[model samples]
Target: MDGILVGNRLIDAGEYELAIDAFTRAALDQGLSADVLAGMGSANLGLGRVHTAERLLRDALEKDETSPEIWNNLGVALLEKGEIAEAEQVLKRAYALDNGQSDSIRDNLRLVLAKTENSVYDEPQEQDYKLIRRGSSDYMIRTISD
Candidate 1:
């Protein structure tokens, strides 16, 4: 079975508690694609494991540093950790990487900025869905891992 498929199952099962371990295992075990890293990062982020999530996300980014998805997620992790400056920087990188991904990057940037300001804006209110790092390239794994 595909690592992404299995990872998605764990995520849907709300077993994110175990999904990271599973994803990490699958990725390393199979020498899988960047999707594996994305899944692991997502699971860790769900568990509020920012550092781990960042690591995984970085791995994904290193595989494809130009991917807006990776940059956006790194920004989100930094944002949630109250690293607004870092978050903004990542967001900018994401936006610069792909203008086509502007919506996601903008939304993520808005969320972090709002949190920083504690401003009352129309939040997404989509609790189950969050900004996860995805779509990184295989090449990005090396640089991001470091």
Candidate 2:
């Protein structure tokens, strides 16, 4: 459980690579639990590997369907993949499962709702560039317009 705790803290600190390592170590040592799978899924999500994250979260859910955190992370993976409708439904499920106790889940649900509302009238457009952040804690998203 110590490794899982370390992995969780690493994830919260935004050290995704290190968190993955920690979770991997935990899985090797104590076997894969739903918590470990969720931590790895969340780490992959933070690394922008949405498909991998989704897969991992799904596996975690199969092991423990009652986990709100797993559902929330799965919803985030779907959201990042642009499956807004499915993301909204999954996030709402997470919110309901958790009894609306998680602010992050609520915020993510709101974000999906807002995006879905905006996408109704806006045609799909190709994006030339995307904003990326650097460093730890302190970060910024700069748009490089063509």
Candidate 3:
């Protein structure tokens, strides 16, 4: 199989290091396409390398701005870096570009909005819930009221 396909499969299997190796090989052989860059970015993101993921995803977007997958991955990278506002904008753009067909994009946008909306409180007394990531997904859980 091609390196790109292998990279994607490795990503799906949560083998981020292997995925990055596969993506790098593909990039060296075929030059970096949007899909390859996206895969690399996502693998980096999975490994908690937010800055590297952001750069690669941005490069992917430059090569092909029309891909919702790239935009969504970029948004995720931004969110991981705590760039909530930019992440929201990019995720919204991805949702719009996909015509709201991507549930993952929609969920990401919702997560950003939830984080932003709940972060406005000045004290723990005023806060109701906190967003937490469990495994590969995020959840808003109610905090113990003081």
Candidate 4:
């Protein structure tokens, strides 16, 4: 199987370390392609290495700016790191690039909007914002009101 494909499968299975290794092998074999970089970033994000993930994702974006998946992944990393504003913009771009066809992107956008509103209002209530990972590279933020 292709290293990137294996890496993506490992990511879907939550084997982030294995995914990273797979992505690394893919990078070595493929000369640091955008897909390899994005796979590496996704694995890093799964491992909670936000800085590394952000850097790799940014690099991936530089290589291929038209990929909504990379933008969404970057947005998720930013959101997890509490960079809500940038997350919102990144997710917005992802949504636009996807033509609003992806539910995961839409959910992420909703999450960003909720976070932005929460920050803007400066009101602390009983709302739980949960970041839910969906499938291989999709994320959904569930808001539970208490």
Top TM-score: which candidate number?
A: 4
Estimate the Cα RMSD of every predicted model relative to the unseen true structure: 8.6, 5.1, 5.3, 2.3
Measured against the true structure, the TM-scores of the candidates, in listed sequence, are 0.67, 0.81, 0.81, 0.89
Model 3 ranges off by over 4 Å = 122-146
Clashing pairs in 4: none
Predicted structure 3, TM vs. truth: 0.81
lDDT value, candidate 3, whole model: 0.74
- Candidate 1: worst 10 consecutive residues by lDDT? 137-146
Instruction: Summarize candidate 4's per-residue lDDT along 37-66 as a digit string, tens digits.
Output: 999998888788989999999999999999
Candidate 2 C-alpha lDDT tens digits along 58-143: 99988999887778778777877778899889888988997988766776677678768978988874433231322221111222
Residue 5 accuracy (lDDT) in model 4: 93
Given candidate 2, what's the lDDT at residue 44? 84
* Greater-lDDT candidate between 1 and 2: 2
Clash list (residue pairs), candidate 3 = none
Clashes per model (N, Cα, C within 3 A) = 8, 0, 0, 0
Model 1: clashing residue pairs? Answer: 58-144, 62-140, 62-141, 62-144, 63-139, 63-140, 63-141, 64-140
lDDT of 3 at 49: 85
lDDT of each: 0.65, 0.74, 0.74, 0.86
